[model samples]
Target: MLPDADAVSRAAADLIGSAVRAGATTLGVATGSSPLGTYAELGRRVAAGGLSLAGCDAYLLDEYVGLGADHPQAYRCVIRRELVRRTDLGDGHVHGPHGDADDLDAEARRFEEEVRRARIGVQVLGIGSNGHLGFNEPGSPLDSLTRVVELTERTRADNARFFDRPEDVPRRVLTQGLGTILRAERLVLLALGERKADALAAALTGPVNPDCPASVLQCHPDVHVLADPGAARGLLDSPRRR
Candidate 1:
């Protein structure tokens, strides 16, 4: 496990930079407190001429429904402010599902098609205290695809810090499915703090089941998990946690 959040971020950035340098054409970026440092490190790398993401297509893991284009908490806007604006990523090539679409189902289909058309070579993720990945809450099926999902109260509460109040958080989201996330050539997950300990442990060491949506990563061929001391505490008992 990393010594602190900053170390985790640097390690994640190193992997992502390596992927880009090795000819990866598509990258998936995740938004949340856990990944913010990693994005910052990527920005520093680009500024130093050590990395470049301008040639890659970037996809967001999820977006809140009904958030306006200017909504500061909107995942798209957050991504723009945190990663795209901070690095060499092209603004026009960053794509996310149209969460506020008039026809949610159709939009889901379209977004999934877009992601599949240009596969994501690398994906970054963060686990929710409730075991969610990309808004796929605890009960999400292993084979689920990109779709709209009602936000779990627990998940909403955890994300409330991003908004002015708990009620201000959106009630629904469009997120890539477990299957869709697995399609990426490689995956990197960063989980920090004691709050994420249970889910983090379960995702890496527990059974591959729907109860913990992120547990589906166990089926993936390539996945790298980074956790701080607090988050890795539960893994101490599981040899399989590796």
Candidate 2:
């Protein structure tokens, strides 16, 4: 486990930098408190001219349904403000499923196609308190594709801090599915705080099942989990690694 979230961020930066230097142009990224530090570090490197995302493309992991692109709490807006604007990627290079689309199913299919064409080289993710990856909450199909999902109360409650009121949080979201996330050549999952301890342990050591969506990562060939001590506390034995 990492000393803290900052260390995790630095480690993630090194990994991402290696990928970028190795000519990986397509990236899949997540938005949330967990990724904020990582994005900040990457942004700093880009600003210092130590790195560049000039022609690289990024796809967001998910977006809350009913929230417009410009909505302050919208995942798209959050990603743009937190990462894309701070890096060299153009407005058009970073894409997200249209949460406000009239035909959400069609939009999901279209987004699935877009990612398939891009062939993501690296995917960064954050697990939910309920062991979810993206918005694929408990009971989500293991082979589900990009699609709409009803947000769990736990998730909505966790995200409520971003809105003025708990009721203001969207009830649904469009997210890349476990199967879709597994398509990436590499995967990095981050978790921090004691709040995530149980979920982190379950995700890494529990059975691979739809009941705990993040557990599906166990099936991936190249999955890296970065966690702080508090988040790794639930593991039976040693969870930390160099």
Candidate 3:
């Protein structure tokens, strides 16, 4: 039952279109290689005669602490290059954690409030090979909200692809916790490639545990996991999709 990347992107576009039609003003997004295709497709739709993000408000999922907002690999910069700058969404509507904030906790609280007020209509997520969601590594509580977190070695390694050198990746990050992400009315979790198969299967069938933080999605009211055949190998073999 696993879908290819194109299927996932089309499904995401359909969700975005529905939200636009319903007058949704805000969207929560994740930044990573897994989401690149969806963003690209969305950008294409805007480029063609499909949809526009003119009045949309976008909230990013996480930001590495200590990285300058303008840092090329920073989530802000990535979002700008990949999605925001390419869309009609006004510059003022794009929101992400302030990595330079003097009071990190206060900043996290403010972000939580903004999300609450915006009432995000759709949230896009990328799964870590270790099953984390938005930097909420294993053991993160399902009810957690925005907070500062120490990046796990595995996560840092996985994210190193975006940095000039592996060591350049940040050791810490500020992320909207599982609770914050689940607040969105709809959620789309995208995964691709064989590298993600084990984690995806664990999330879909294994017991919900902090070790596999993304497993919390099982409790979400409206969550759709979209994975390519390579990533869905085990799940397809399971009795569920059958």
Candidate 4:
């Protein structure tokens, strides 16, 4: 609940910078307008010679299935344009879940293994309007593994602005499981606007159940959730919604 989105981004960027200063070598990155400001702040710091991501390895939390590597809306390309290309981070140090793989199951296993080996120290995330973490939609199991999932209609429609038409958004994606995300040493979740108010409130104060996947964040020991006034209105207006 900082002043606004810009303030929230500054706080988030400070947290990330602290992690890097503490020798954190692996970073988990997410795609979405919610995190764009934070990435921009980081890039500003790098430009000022106050930070460097050269020593860090970045991991993607999810990727749309069936989108080609060249797709503009692909998580890979989005991250590149928003984060990687803006900072010292290079393509060689970036890793993403292979959503377009021929063997989806095998790809999931490999991605999970790679993430486990890297042992991410800081993970950035953005909450979907429907309480999704990454591409993990409502009803995603708390202990699920890296795997494929169908995009909720609400999520598809929310992302339609990134495509030419509502039908152009990918129907499926490969996302890191709740379990995988919990393994990170730190987690920062960003929520913005009134559109995310209901979901953020449910996730923060409601029961920890699959019906609200992001509710599982309550189980994380080092999770930090940042939301604007509109998004935090529910939490502020009442002690609990459930």
Candidate 5:
């Protein structure tokens, strides 16, 4: 069943709380509007009750290739502005691919190794309008791991909001592939808005296809989808929700 975004955030916070209590050391996180509420609520928890993140390790899902680390819309900057700076997670705990690195391949491999060593306890994801998960666009191999990807025309258009002009958007990205994301013991996906309703229905009720990469989550044992009422408009009529 589709859940409201706030309910999803609360559930994610509860899971994070449980993980902290259980001594989980690593977390996989994603960017975009869908996770904004989750991060906000988590920040509140840190403020109100002292949810310690000092010992936790964090791995971000993706990053644009040419954007500077300080770019306001860069994933690194977004993480810092949203969750990292708001909480007590130390400087070294938050990890993401080096967007400005000279060696992109080496950076990708390093990220993959970090994930291998950390063994993420939970992964938070936000589905793309085109059904991508972490820049793993249509036809990405189900078992693929970390890699550099050329953003599709649709993806570039969707992300143009972060750039001054459509031409300013980067054409390529580095992201954890489907296999890398699925390696997390638990996965939480957040979707919202009417524009996302069709994609949500396709992902939850339609056949699993490379064309709709998010649909693959249906096969995972521990995947939870969180969508607001607008995003769940079609889902409300689905048999599973009823």
Candidate 6:
């Protein structure tokens, strides 16, 4: 486990940089607090001429449904502000499911086709305190594909911090499901803070079940987990409480 969040971010960045240098063309990126440091490090590397993501195609892991284009909390807007604007990846190279679509099911199909065409090389993820990856909350099917899902109250509550009020958070989302995310050549799951400790432990060592959706990563051939001490406490048997 890493000493702190910064170290975990650097480790994740180093791996991503190596992947890019080795000619990985597609990247799947995650939003939220977990990946902020990693994206910042990537932006710094680009600014220093040490790295470039110019031609890399970026796919967002998920998006909230019904948010307007100008909504600050919209996943697409968040991605542009947090990563794309800070790096060499052009806006055209970044894609996310159309959460505002008139027909959500058709949008999900279109997103699946787009991702299938691009073939994601590496996917970055964050384990929810409820053991979710992307928006695949508890009880999501193991073989689920890109689809729209009702947001669990727990998931909505956790995300409330990003909005002005708890009720302002969207009630549904379009997310790359367990099956779709598993198609990536590699997975990097990042977790930080004591709040994520229990989930991280379940994802790393518990049964590969839909109840703890992230646990399915155990079956993946190439999965990298980067967590700070606080988040790793459960696995390490530390005295830190979650």
Writing each residue's lDDT as its tens digit, candidate 6 over 1-242 gives: 99999999999999899999999989999999999999999999999999999989899999999996568998889888989989999988889898899999999999998998889989999999999999999999998999999999998999999999999999999999899999999999999999999998887777788989998898899999999989999899734221
Q: Judge candidate 2 at residue 35 and give its lDDT.
A: 91
lDDT of each: 0.91, 0.90, 0.86, 0.90, 0.84, 0.92
Which stretches of candidate 2 lie above 4 Å from their native place? 236-242
RMSD of each: 1.3, 2.3, 1.9, 1.1, 2.3, 2.5
Clashes of each: 0, 1, 1, 0, 0, 0
Worst 10 residues of 3 by lDDT: 233-242
Error of 3 at 55 (Å): 1.5
Candidate 4 — which pairs collide? none
Sort every candidate by lDDT, greatest first. 6, 1, 4, 2, 3, 5
How high is the lDDT of residue 177 in model 3? Answer: 90
Off by over 4 Å in 5: 1-4, 238-242
Q: Is candidate 2 or candidate 5 better by lDDT?
A: 2
Cα deviation of 235, candidate 3, in Å:
0.6
Alpha-carbon error at 38 in model 4, in Å? 0.6
Candidate 4 stretches greater than 4 Å from native? none
